[model samples]
Target: MIEHRRIAHSLVWSTVALGALALTGCATTDKGGSSNLPTPDAYAELRDARGADRGRVDIFRDSSGLRLEVVARGFGPGTYGMHVHAVGQCAAPDFSSAGPHWNPTGAQHGRDNPMGAHHGDLPNLVVESGMIGRATLHMVGSRLTGEGGLLDADGAAFVIHAGPDDMRTDPAGNSGGRVACGVIATPAG
Candidate 1:
């Protein structure tokens, strides 16, 4: 009788542990089913025109939406406009090489625009006296893979402008010139 009681107690604890693990696994799945997205991926590297490491951007997928964490440094002390550009090139002096904002849906520019905001529209980054800024953005209607994704064939870039985004103008909200740019890429295994 004593041996049977001990076995039963051990079985109960083992079952509880297994149940917890199953719940944890289920929490990681996406709405449709299991998620195929990458977690904690260093998807992009930002740099200034002088080829200095200004920051890095990480991409992660969760049940809520796609999350982007932008860690920046060595920037002017003010609010700067940041966006995901269409191209991956970052030509120095002028970052026109980055092309325009990522707008796969043909939407108008600016988050405040009544027409629509571009897919790459993101909140402005505010830098203090230390010249550092960090922002975590939750992106809906976007993904890290598949069609119209950030990691698409042509690739995408992160662009930081000299001024704040007006959030209501077409073609870039008069965000001024691109002060810094970073191309998003997948890391090697």
Candidate 2:
């Protein structure tokens, strides 16, 4: 009888340990449907021309596509054009150092263009009374890693323009001057 009691106790403890391990495995896979991809592969810290912290952008990779989460503040209330520029530099005031819009496939400038749009053209961002806004954008032709990734070679940048993107013009959608900029890079582990 003593030996039987000891075996039963050991069985109960083993069952409890297995249950705990299963629960932990489920918790780690709760990232929507991205069970196979890394949560956030890259990040960008955005700033105004004065070099003050505006907000940040996080890039995530999943089986469906690439996801970009942009959060920003401290601008005047209005709609602004935003895009990924070709270069990584974010010189103050004009931000010309960031170069033109990212166009890896050599596509045209706007989403409304018949020839096709540039890889960097994103939706317009609207700021409310407190000058704050956040948006999540998804893309099928881009990724945060390898080959034509946003962090490739010359790198890329997020840029905010003074005017709205007309969605049909060439070169830059006549978005006017760049108001804010941020360079995209892989976050340090």
lDDT of 1 by residue, 1-189 (tens): 999999999999999999999887767421223445444653677778788888878777767657888888888789999999998889897889889999888999998999979789998998887878989988788776688887787788889898999998888988889988888776654
How many collisions per candidate? 0, 0
Estimate candidate 2's alpha-carbon lDDT, on a 0 to 1 scale: 0.83
Candidate 2 lDDT over 1-189, as tens digits, reads 999999999999999999999876666332234354455677678888889988778788867667888888787888889999989889898889999998788889888999878789998988887888888987667876577777788899999898889998898998889888999887565
Model 1 score (lDDT): 0.82
**Which numbered prediction scores highest in TM-score against the true structure?**
2
- Candidate 2 backbone clash number: 0
- List candidate 2 stretches off by more than 4 Å: 1-39
All candidates: TM-score: 0.76, 0.76
What's the true lDDT of residue 60 in model 2? 84
Each candidate's lDDT (Cα)?
0.82, 0.83
